[model samples]
Target: MPKSVLLLWLEGHLQSWGYDSKFGVRETLPFPTKSGVIGLICCALGEKDPQDDFLKELASSTMEVKAYKNKFNDKTEQGLSLIMRDFQTIGTNYDESDPFKNLMIPKKSDGTKPVGSGAVLTYRYAIQNGKFAVFLEYEKDLAQAVYKALQKPRWDLYLGRKSYIPTEFIAQGIFNSKEEASQKLRQLAEIKKLTEDFSVVEGKNCDDCDVLLLNDVPVSFGRRKSYANRYVSIIKKED
Candidate 1:
């Protein structure tokens, strides 16, 4: 049987996928890692750590990805260019002053968990003007259910990092084809009466632009670390 795919477009000023993050400072993995996406699924299901059996089952499924290039336009010349960069993390130097340092370190359950050997995999796609698409493949029934839930989401959508909550619904919907998905997204833009800031288009790569990928590196809290990733990019929307 053919796999069912749910195509979602996340358009926003900033997006981050935090795989392994700790306290005050968070860290973002290069691409949307399996753990990160699984965390999302858990969140959607209103679950937390000490995961249940269902969570394990969900994590055992297959996932794939394809990233695209982001582009920007030169106002003076009305020319478009690709804006891309390799992201890096800068750590803040600080001395460990914790009295419970010995007891706070990871135990077997925390440190032994594998990062990549799971059911979820994500691709990072950067689009021109902050527009990008995500294609999720899963069991047909599950895919359809997820697609339907996303259309009128019960919970607010935020970049993997919770700090950057989207002002609008980032995902448009699941569609039969890319073209159909694009058209539906356009229709949504029209309904919202949005302008170029919310424009959706087709293209894989960007040219002649400086797109920087920011990776959030985790920092320590007091005893336990925060799960949120802190990597973010602030883009000024052109009017």
Candidate 2:
């Protein structure tokens, strides 16, 4: 069966696509991860259960991302979007007497207070003023359903973080082929005055691209989340 392409335009002031992160530090990749994209879709579909079967099919589907940045000018601060780190302190102060408030306090695995201060410091990284055009290849029926859901999402849609709401519509259009999706992206970029930074494509390594093994594939979601690795090719372009 011929595949259809669902084009998503991800643009926001602050968006974080967490690749490898710990409790102390949450790091973000330059582009959207597969898990992140899938999570957004699940939210749009209003699916609470873990979609393990859907993920299995998604793992084999082709997905491509083209990164874009605002054109450099005297008014703009930088030519490329930069990563911004946000520091937060949790469990600073809470009354133990109140049951609800006590849960907010930091505790050990055994529900005991720490010997030192109860405050926990965490650093979150996000891409500032980042834009991306994502093309996802899917079967015709699945693509149409996803396209409709994104158009009128059951749940609110955010870029990567809940606070980072999308400035534009997430569903751009559904195309019959990747070339058609690329055409739409070019038109949108021209209207937005954005310049291409790079492209990430899935598959074997090529001489002109950089190969990266990313563990962004979702095996299961919910409390105990896991992922598998996939090879991607990154091709950088000049201004």
Candidate 3:
């Protein structure tokens, strides 16, 4: 089957996509990750489960992404946004008198049960002037569904986190092949004079880019999440 691509504009002041976290410290990638983009699509289609068949199908497909600054550059693409960190406290200021509020407190995942309430301060990272043009080579049916859903999303859409809502609608159009879709992105970028910051490519070897073993593939989006592995080539422009 011919591949279909999805174009999205992920502009947010605060967007954190952390696949691996230790303790309360979370970090963000400069560009959108595969799992992150997939998560966004599933959210639009109201497919909450990571184990959803659609999720699996998408994980098995080929995908590519590029992050660009909204501001036009001098073609050097030297301008990449810096990641800003936010320190936040979870489970803060709940009235002890309210019994229901106590239940809302975060708990340890010891598999047995949680005792008492735990609140901790954590650090999150995000990029400024974040804009991305994604080219997902996925199944046609799934792509069509996603395009339609974005017009009237089944759930509220956000980039990575709930607070990181998109400033613009994501769906640009569905196209055949990566080049055709990417061509559209280039046109838009040309008009806006956007500069590419970095890009991620899947499956194939990107000799010009650095390779990474990312654990962002979704096997199950359920409560007990499961993940598969995907290779990403990080291509950055020299400053």
Candidate 4:
């Protein structure tokens, strides 16, 4: 049997997928991560804990991502998008009386107040206006649920974070094969005048891949999120 491919359009003024981050500098992988993709699916289904069997099915399924440049620029250019860092800071701007202000303070695992404020300046990287085509292999029933949720999500749908909203619709359609679905999606997008700038697929289809270890697989994701380690390949391209 052939696999099912779901076409998604990811485009926004600012979007960030922080695969590995500690404190000061938060960076994004050139493409999306399995954790992020699974998270999106869980959120769509309104699944509180992402480590459930639903997520397990998604994580185990194959994901092939193709990142594209902004459509405004030359389509054939393939100039390669840029990952710009967004400088941000917290705590100082919050009002003392507002309960929301307390969020600026770091809390312990037990939710106890900290000794000092967690206010600090930091940089977050994002692939601005980047488009991506995600091909997935999942059971038919589950795919239908996901497609419905995406059309009218139980929660807000985001690229990698709540702040990054896709400019266009993310759920295009579901088809029997990746090629057929993608081809039809392109046609529809052209009629609607959407972006179709193709990007390199490092691990599955592209070349000169640099495989790296990523620990983004979800072990549990409700109040406490846990993850297991997995190997992923990074694709590099010329500007």
Query: Residue 226 lDDT in model 1?
Result: 34
For residues 130-167, could you state the per-residue lDDT of candidate 1 as single tens digits?
33344556666776766665655555556565654554
Q: What lDDT tens digits, residue by residue, belong to model 4 across residues 66-144?
A: 6654344434444335688888875454665778876666556798764566566788888876667777766777777
Give all candidate RMSDs, comma-separated: 12.7, 2.5, 3.6, 4.4
Best by lDDT: 2
Best by TM-score: 2
* TM-score of every candidate relative to the true structure: 0.44, 0.90, 0.85, 0.78
Q: Over 4 Å off in model 1, which ranges? A: 45-51, 72-132, 167-172, 175-239
Question: Model 3, poorest ten-residue lDDT window?
Answer: 70-79
Which residue runs does candidate 3 get wrong by more than 4 Å?
Answer: 70-78, 97-100, 104-119
Instruction: Please write out the lDDT profile of model 3 over residues 156-236, one tens digit for every residue.
Output: 888888888888768888887667777888888887777777787875476767888888888787788778887788778
Global lDDT of each model? 0.43, 0.85, 0.75, 0.70
Error of 2 at 82 (Å): 0.5
What C-alpha lDDT, on a 0 to 100 scale, does residue 197 get in candidate 1? 29
Higher-ranked by lDDT: 2 or 4: 2
